[model samples]
Target: MNGDDELSLLSWMYGHDHDDPVPAPRLGQGYVELSGGPLDGSLLDVTSWTEDEIATGAVLMTVLGQTGPDGQARYAARPGDPGRWDWSGDAV
Candidate 1:
């Protein structure tokens, strides 16, 4: 494999330089509109969402921009460090 091929494989094996798909947002009951960040202009019609989905999303989004209980930013400064990735995908 070439250098690019090896890099692509490594990226896929880990989270680095990856873009995992978030669930496709859809309409349901109540609605939410994301006004900023990568989700800018995204709308959530929570009506169709399962309670578990909403709960999971709620907890995940809440910590993305907030300090932890100890007050450190959710992400680190040189966050590209492999150990810094939140593999569990839990923020709080």
Candidate 2:
């Protein structure tokens, strides 16, 4: 694999959860809209989203090790290396 591929895998295996809080905004049918601030506190402009979109994003993030407690996967930072990753919770 290329360097980018390796780095992508590494990030997937050792990425942190999205640090920003999800803003609880009013949403219309099939779409949630953010009035102020970036969506998910991200700098990018994310104007709208749907429940299915959110669920799919969460699932993908979990698979990529960027999930928090709410996500399906559980993770903890390594002792010495903050970037390293491992599962932290009860088995099964």
Candidate 2 residues lying further than 4 Å off, grouped into runs, are 1-5, 9-71, 90-92
lDDT of 1: 0.34
Give every collision pair in model 2. Answer: none
Q: List the residue pairs that clash in candidate 1.
A: 28-47, 28-48, 29-47
TM-score of 1: 0.27
Instruction: List clash counts for every candidate, in order.
Output: 3, 0
lDDT (tens digit, per residue) of candidate 1 on 1-92: 79843432333121112354633332233544333332333333456667555444432233244443322222211133322222232343
**Looking at model 2, how many pairs of residues clash?**
0
The TM-score values for the models, in the order shown, are: 0.27, 0.25
Runs with alpha carbons beyond 4 Å of true place in candidate 1: 1-28, 58-92
| 1-90: candidate 2 lDDT, tens digit per residue | 898434433331113235534322223312211112112211211235453444333211233223444344433333554323334432
**Least accurate 10 contiguous residues by lDDT in model 2:** 33-42
